[model samples]
Target: MDLIGAYSDDGAPSPSRSGDGTAALAVVSAAPEVRCGTCHARHFPLSSCISNGIYASSQVDASGYALVESKLVSQEDTKFFQGANTRMIRYNLPADQMHAPVQGPTHPSGRKADGGLSNHRTGHVEDSHLSSYAFDEQYNSFHSDGVAMDPSRPVAISLGPGVGAPPTQPQQKRQRTQQSKVAPAPVDLTQPFTLRTRQPWAEKAAFPEQELTEEHRAYLEKEEKAEKDAGSGKGETSIFHGKALEDYQGRSWLEAPRDLRDDSATSFLPKKHLHTWSGHTKGVNAIRFFPSTGHLLLSAGLDGKVKMWDVHNQRKCLRTYLGHTKGVRDAWFSNDGRKFVTTGYDKVIRLWDSETGAVLGKYGEGKMAYTVRFHPDDDKQNMLMAGMADKKILQMDTDTGDVVQSYDYHLGAVNTVTFIDEGRRFVSTSDDKTIRVWEFGIPVQIKYIADPAMHAISAVSVTPNKKWWCGQSMDNKIVTYSATDRVKPNTKKTFAGHNVAGYACEVSFSPDSRYVTSGDGEGKLFMWDWKTKKIARTIKAHEGVCIGSAWHPLETSRVATCGWDGLIKYWD
Candidate 1:
């Protein structure tokens, strides 16, 4: 089965087919005609066609179909096929082959035309002019006429220099039409797809009934009332309305400054002052006041030194405790003010006698300890919770220095830990972008707060009165949460407007729970109106990262902050 040539209306082969078969060529026609030699079938209206002398002439039918055939030719064979060439040739004698001659008169009926086949040059069919209909017959077999085509014995036409060798087998063409890939039906995006054999499950678990008791409800109401009253003066401009406070970019605190500060007092005394007693060569990480006398302050620093300070005098290091092998990350005083605990990068928490600076006990083995805080109301029986760089929380018994429980709740290092209301519950924040509340007996998560900004929560503190809790984030915002039942638990209020990236290292509330104070990465101390969610006062508190802050337990007018600058600043 070989392709001789495509027939032209003028009975000549295309000029472009004269060169080597590999030369790129295009065939143009309104509707090219095709014939099959096998069945003497003719097909018409070819969409696209390529010619190769080695392959059979095949064309698409009216419905866009084509047939391809292949034959094994031997070098010894002379004639192309064993049969006579009559079947592959077409005669011009048939009226169907020609339209009326443009200007010629018809021959007299039954009489032979004067120009016989021998005398005619272009008008009559000669051996050279015979149309190869038999060759066209083999090309038409590729069509199916709206019927399924045989997959096993399919056909393809080979073009170019490789023509007439053998046609490639038809392949399953990729379904490129968009309609062919559509499903039988459309799916609804809003509906959950459920398998019939499976049971439906709740997406989120409900809060336990015990958590919403009458006592809890009453507390929430009281807290809510207090918060509302504090923000009521600003009406719709209030920022504490949602589960988390969002930035109101165009609105500046300066536009509403009076609403954030109390100008009633004539003295410049703050509600509390943090006296930094500096002896470490590096930044202080934690601070605690003596439980018996609020005048004594204890601080731990990255320089691996712990210092006790006398708040009454100029901020000076009164005593230094050296034991930890690495930087001290956290420090806390026992309830009786006679002892303190310090945790550090050395992976140990050491209990120390407050008066003599004696190492009482050592707990924690190989984990990098981040923070340590004592239970609020107990001296002998204290809860020491420490944050670990290994993404875990450890609760230890202060008396025995033994780990009581370990929590693997955070995905990243736990940065801060603080107890809520007498160590009955506690809150922890982490670089994993979540804050969690843990109750004493329950192992499961009680409340979880996620920040959409995904910033690490660097520090968390619960107010002394237990009315509110505040967390500082790496996103330069201070978030406040209400602890009382008068308001919704876990709701956050964000205070923005820090010129530099704020790493809220410490946060505390005034005794009245009216003002919130935070230390930033730049050693700036910002006091925010808890109710208004606006910055009340800004103090140049330190020269570097202000890592720790504490309020004067008795003096409600002063606060202190320690920083990387190896200095602690007192604000009033």
Candidate 2:
């Protein structure tokens, strides 16, 4: 007798006693279970089966299969099959990989009146599947040879038709046990679910169809091992095993223009690191965009050179900038893509045409320019700002090779200077533990922001709307303050997790200002939600301290990171 229809030789309930009073062999059901046709993965999800009603059974009277009893299948079971809650979920349903519906016992409502397999477009068995449960004939009682519990066999179980002792109830197929008392509740797919139980199916045993022959099993295992060994290396391109089960060609996801396709337009959230650049021989300190409406990336290294790369194809360096006499500290692109600028410890600031990589002007006057930034205006090529090691903020008029504006208020080295409010005023942070906000071309500072928690602000960034500004403190914290209320310097929020630890860690906002991102001294990147002040992610990105990071100005998804390990990485 099968598991579901099991009966004693006398047509009584099973767990039959043998001569020595031990139970007889296990009752394995002859029922067929749903499974993936291609990969041979077992059991269709309740959602997949119920999308067409009850599960399509393979049993039928004309095929000599025993009729199923209607009393065994309660309405509760049918309801469970149609619910949204399920233990398994199919993430994607590619048309080419879709299995054809088995044309056997189907649900009444599931089948079309034409008597064909229901829902031919997708895949569903016919409604006659319910007809198998006629409840008219008493299923015949079949006997099996008793299972012999041999001490020589560890786990191997042998069963034959007719005669000896039964296996333990724990080992009985589909026999309900006290598993529910010790284990967590299974996801009852017919009910509304509240809690998430990840991978609940792993706790259950597989159906017989899930079992494979030795040869087929070995072949699949070998292919799986090979795919993992090859990984995404050696022209594999994708991390997925494209050689084996993934060979089925599906309909192209990219058919129409990007925006018109399935309404999933592009977004730039650094989901995964795509490529790494190790072109620099020394630590990389700066990274900037090539100012392209298309795609380009620029990075400056302590090796005393700057490299340009295609943003989409980052492995190959497109061009190299080589004028710095010493390690380059920073680089910036003009609002227009025509030119860009760089600064170095060699006491000079150099401007070059972006296209030919030719030096256009050398602007620092025997001062080690520590930081540089291009004017925000597209037409303001002559206007730019730089901080010198001499504790001076110098604004250069490249047109006349003169430092027309100078602000020498800070007692310590100026760490960073950035324009705000349409370049009408700018903010500067120094090693002296002060943040000075000043109007452009004015010699004296106008506003001073010094918070007790502002432990050595190493980097500062302004929100896109100029409503707020933030400082990355070396004391392993980032603090934000209101930009509009300069008198109060109203502390907005603070984010922590990454260890800056007295190093120059770069910080900035997402393009929409929803997030504040930073690089830490521990070679990691942290992103914080502005309102929640909670860290969204902490990414281990480099071997050494990560010094600089830049999110794409337009795309929310792409971010470039630089580290003291002399590597630049792009994540999207």
Candidate 3:
């Protein structure tokens, strides 16, 4: 049976050859003279050919109705099966090829005859033959970073360059110049300059200026009235939402003391093990210190949970936050550290209270979110950015779950998104083997680091000064690129001698931008001096692959690492 069309147990009659040679020739040779009336006319409806096959040669069926006959494959016409392998699938499909009727003249709505209303417009200019693309290979596509302003703008790269490929340098540079981002400039013109959203998912306003929905407005009004009636109870209210945590603790919530480690002790990392926080039952996936309080380290694990710890006290788990239905992939703290965001294979983004471990809100990403980061600026922000498995970088206002912006430039899964250079800009790494540099609010890429070999960048980091960008390759190496403006990445520096193969190992930069550190598939930590581009230390930090590593913001030497072995190790 064929893959299309319904057939009965006793199939309908098909063309066949009779035993008698002279009669068989006459039986199968009743070929109809296929002449198309519409193609000969000025219009041809694609719908009629596709649905009813009216334009093809037809013969009467058992019901005495015309049925467009399916064409048989001609071995000389085309190579229908060139290199097929039966080893992959259990069984082979029927080999005889079948095809639809040959292409007919198309009349896609705009080309009706003069009597119809479609052709009644007398003054409007009709689409000329010169306006249509004549090439058979031409296709439709958006620019990797933005919507193409011209509908017929041709892409340099062909279709299905999956995972990654280096962008054509000349084309990218030309588009960069032509589609310049126009910031508001004072001018003598009559109209003030206005900015618009460049991508469809992007909202025009930032978190603070965004218009509120009816549901959010009602929730805010109720929350505010309740706060006024309470009149300053045991715990303080959220400054942004005026809502208090349901599980608020008395007095010591925000005043919780920092870890007892002395921040003034060391300026350089001492390659030695200090302490291990080891209560998690499954592999630890991510680790980071709180932005507001640098002493508290936060970790998410394969156990579908998140834990906060005092880095100085190895055994004490400060708090356990639970909401995700699957293993937690990544977590990030807000600038104030009062709220944090977490994402996982579950595809849900959860905002949690840093102090009380309460799940405040959530937004469902359609695909698994690999990593998440809080916006660096503190101008009343609740924007949470995440790297999605769907090869896109997305930003959402956690307050209303309104998408602030989305970047669909990556050809593969987005693995990392990190803010660099005092948080004015950020970089995203993808399995597509490209690292893109983007400004905070700009909709297009400012810079790109593309490797020709399509080496998946599992993770990436940027220096504090934003002078350099680094990416972690599955080839067990860390590659560096210049992030300074007025430069394009044609050459990349490679740091070798680490084993990150088979693991999406996370990477980080020292607070001073002098050292680059990353974990390997072998559960060891690799730290390299950026200036010398040499390995400084390689220590066994975990029994399994270490996927997360972080350097303290306030302290230059203190570092934390977490791995699949379910241990969080601290070092200084």
The lDDT for every candidate, in the order shown, is: 0.61, 0.66, 0.65
Candidate 1 per-residue lDDT over residues 1-572, each given as its tens digit: 01334444576544234554322222323345567543345533231233433233463343332222243444322232234334653322322122333235656673344334333545554343424673343444323222222222243443434344322344223443444465424333355663322135432222123558899899889766644532332111111111222236654211222223332322233644444455678877777766534566677888777877656544455567766656877787766776778887666777877655566677776677778777676542467777888988887886776778888878898888877755677788888888788886566667887747657777777766677777776777776667653223344577777633545477776656677777776767777776687788887777877666666665566677788888766666
Across 452-562, the per-residue lDDT of candidate 2 in tens digits comes to 756667788788768877888877888776667452454458888888887888887777777788988888888888888898888898988999888775566678899
RMSD of each: 24.3, 30.6, 25.5
RMSD of 3: 25.5
Model 2's lDDT to the true fold?
0.66
Report the error of model 1 at residue 293, Å.
Answer: 3.4
Q: Please give each candidate's TM-score.
A: 0.54, 0.52, 0.54
lDDT of 3 by residue, 230-344 (tens): 2322122222211332225444434435344445533586566778888789999888786635667788899877887764433367677765556888888787778888887
Model 2: what TM-score? Answer: 0.52
